[model samples]
Target: MSVIKELARIINEGVNTIQSKCDASGKPFPSLDEPYTPESDAVRIQVIADALPIIAAANQLIATLQIPAMSIIVASGYVHVSAAFATIAKANVVEALREAGPQGLHVKEIVEKIKKPMDPAKLARMLRICATYHIFREVAPDVFTNNRISSLLDKGKPLKEILAKPLEAFDESPGCAAFVDILIDESFKAAAVTQDHLMDPSTAFSDEPNQLPIQRAMHTNKALFEWYDEPGNELRRRRFNIAMKESVKFEVPGAILQGFDWGALPKGSKVVDVGGGIGGTTMALYDIHKHLRYVIQDREAVIKQAQQVWQTERPEALENDTLALQPHNFFEKQPVKDASVFLLRTVIHDWSDRYARTILTHLRAAAAPYTQLVLVDQVAPLACSEDGISDVPGATAPTAPPPLLPNFGLAGSMVYNLDIQMILLCGGEERTVLKISQLLSSAGWKLQRIARVPGNLLHKIIATPA
Candidate 1:
């Protein structure tokens, strides 16, 4: 197959795998887990294990490009080799070494064994370059062996479904093509020119730092609810929505439901889901606290889509009067009077601190005395090591100590990956506990408590207006 075809194929497969696993794992989304023992057939796992380094290399390249430019770089070789080489995934080098085994293998042998039908000369050159990074041990000039990082490529480690799908899926999607093209263009510009100048806002790039190419491909054309507004844009809208859904499948809102303590609310109190997308979190919360009156507030267009989903999937579950779909632009004042609980999920992160403060300030004013303000997003844990252990008490703890604990791998993967995504997308940052506390305090809310839920994948910072 052609290089772009192969590249797209791999990209889609990796993303799909990540998404599917997130759904299966029952967290807010899919998370990567470590492999142990032998499960499934060894050969298939070996293929994944073998593919790790190559994928890592690809991701490294992908990461270097602005999010918008990634797809284009792969499709058209739109990226410069120098930039691509710089962005290669360190994980790839490590995996390649792990595959070297005890005796190690010559570059030629490694390529033929792992990828098969290899050109000996090309393989030799790639291996030599990889050796420079200590991805493998250079036993002989052209031979290599596994090292600490390479060992992680072992089979059974959780990979997301989005990353594991067949190439045809990506090849079939026009949005994917557009997204890739723009991503590449943006990546080239960023890699060659922009990031360094970003520290100073005086630079031209700062005018729209977040408007990178990927944002154009994903949000501008496809948009979250633009289809509902324009009849001809239905396909784009639906496709965009699916991409958003796929992107966040593993980020299960239900996990937040688990962390939340409903008993703290007054018995007959009301909770409103402001700007709640698709009612995923609303449904999850409803399941958790059946007694709390739940209302959903979003744009009329989105609410139509959400109500339809609820009616088809959960007609009987949601009480007729309890859950009402209302239209309200959060930038304007809130319409609801005397709410006991005001909940915003994945909403606050979309704006700058100034605008974010405006939204929170409005909610704070609307809140009655003793009201709870629940702001839920992927609150990044304080920086921790690969072990997922943090010195802070309320941070995500390993379900059990490392080496034996499945939870350790799960928490580590999600926190690390999401942190990277948040930084790139919109300057919507994931905060540590201290950062979050300060944000809330400045917004006229106080963090009364934080609750961490196991297996669900989220922590609830229950607060009240100060």
Candidate 2:
């Protein structure tokens, strides 16, 4: 059979496996609105694993089998990539129509309701594009409504919330909005000139914060945090906090809770949330492991805010001193010494090799001989070899089945994008398990274990003092 035909057969088999798994459990196939829950999520994971081969094979087959016209369309994807951000900026349009409900609104009516006036003709093209991408529904010409995906982008729920309020009431609770803003405001501009940074020897070789692509692109020597802390950057800092809070959704903090044997630690053991913002991840885990005492540490500004969060959401833990908020910077020596665990979620990836080493070194200094340091972030697969193994040190990544890309291909798209985000925004890059192990060793720690969070992209790099 031809390659396409074979791919089709593979897809059919994968679909059958998925359907069979669902049927055996006697549950409806998961929907976008109501996906598989914790109790019923295992089958979904299995089904996806079963289908990875078919899906990746289909992707490769389709690309290889494309006609000249289709290849040209692929060649012009840069336009589409550029336009995607433009479309996100036009999120207000989607929000206005979403407020109008599923019935949607006429182009002219939506044009007026939005904060900024948009031309009806131009709005039509935007809506048409969104509709083409299955974001909005064009039930009839010029009337658009929200579908499953667009609803997530609606105001107050996600990106729209932070963007809607750029300055006021800004103490960093917003997430999706702030993150989207970061992408549009700083990262996008820097991404456009990334090649320029690479080609320039000074900028390319330098991992110093002020010398990176983003610094050059924006014509500033301030590093990302430095820029956020500058005078007149209150709004920027607040949005960053909001974005960090929202990151809990993506980081899969629950994985750390379940992935680790927290119960193994003695009751009332300490867990220092290094660089914790608002104690969000700690709060989640605290709910499950109530026996442990926790300290949420960060810079003074956010530590103050985190106390307020603890007071409001978890007053008992705060009142009883079971959960404490401390103002401590990770760059300095850790203050809560000899803690049972040091948890840094989405922190290490934000720094370069030298910086990451420093952060680890500081943690190592404060850590007791028995203390475990948890580095929670994405563990990038350095490369996928023909054998389907990742070239990572001190650990192993899950191998994809035959006919599947070694690292799950499109399913791993966000990982690849985030790896670049590390470089574009900061002079950092995601590391393989091996790289992480090397870093840990240099910081006077040994790689103990790697824990995977089910249904999430983040990994737990557990280490101990050497």
Candidate 3:
């Protein structure tokens, strides 16, 4: 069959699966016109899984059908849409629209509600571009309302509250807004300078975190995290912290449970959460397996923040010694010498292999003979089939059926997009399983098994002392 025909068949199959699931559950198949909601139904979950290949096939079909030059031009012009998205999000347009209700508001009313100095015409244009991409909806000329995608950017705060304290705009947000803000502001800036950084002789061959495109773009000598610490960057730092916590929402609910079994450890066994920001993972684990003791480690600032959080959320854990927040750099010697498990959630992909190895070596040096290392990060896949590498035990790499890109094209683009984001922002790259295995081996750990979190792109790589 022709590629287009195959893609249409895939879409038909997926639509049928969705309809069947929705019909069985007696729930609608969710409309883009409505606001977003958390899906917990078994049928809803299955529908998402069924839809992945269809989305991939559809995107590939569009690319296949479009003229090569026009396709490239369209892709290149997406930066403008990204800028428009950031503008609307940063201006708190979503909150304004939410206040205006489903009837929507004119661009003039939106600007007035936001109490910003934005021009109504310019703002309308920005919203129009996003609406063209199916983010927001234009019910009438110069009037708009929040659709499912646009509503997700709502920070859930009153317009007045957000406007009163711009810096604290994301304080009560679910992290999506903050994540979008940071991605467009800093990550986007870094991406813009990536080619220049790569071509510059000073940083071309450099793997140092300080040599990242972000440093060059920001004209700072400090690494990305260090740059966030400088005075006057408080908002950036706060948003980043919030964004990290919000990232877990993208994973399957209870994805932490899908990985290595924390319940299997003996009661009161030590679980070191390396570079754990605000102890989110540890808190999640504590909720399920209260018998385990967790030591959440990070920079002093983050540890302080984690302490504040734990004090408010789980003071009993601190009082009973079930949880402890320790300020320790992973590159330095690990102080947790008897940990049964070292959990590194979304940590490894933020640094180059050289730095990642150093962090792991420190953990290995401090680990007990039977200690296990669990790495929660994306294992990037190649666009084509068979990424020429030996597989680790328990690792699964599923290829797509013929007529679609092996990695499922745009369905799996997040990992690849994040790979470049890491490179530009932190001199890191998302590794394939083989690369991860090799890095672990160099750091005195053997890759034991890999488990992909259901409904998420992240993988749990469990390793042991070599």
Clashing pairs in 2: 159-176, 159-177, 172-242, 174-242, 393-434
Per-residue CA lDDT of model 1 for 8-81, tens digit only, reads 56556765675565456543221122212223222222233223433543543444444666566554452333
Flag regions of model 1 displaced more than 4 Å.
1-254, 317-319, 382-413
How many clashing residue pairs are found in candidate 1? 43
Extract clashing residue pairs from model 3. none
Give the per-residue lDDT of model 3 (tens digit) for 377-431: 9988877766444456556577778788898889889999889888888888899
Q: What shift in Å separates residue 74 of candidate 3 from its native position after superposition?
A: 0.6
- What's the candidate order when arranged by decreasing lDDT? 3, 2, 1
Q: With candidate 1 superimposed using the best TM-score fit, by how many Å does residue 390's alpha carbon deviate from the native?
A: 13
lDDT values for all models: 0.53, 0.73, 0.86
Give the least accurate 10-residue stretch of model 1, judged by summed lDDT: 29-38
- After superposition on all CA atoms, what RMSD does each candidate show versus the true structure? 14.3, 3.7, 1.5
Per model, how many backbone clashes are there?
43, 5, 0
Distance from true position, residue 262, model 1, in Å? 1.6
Position 363, candidate 3: lDDT = 94
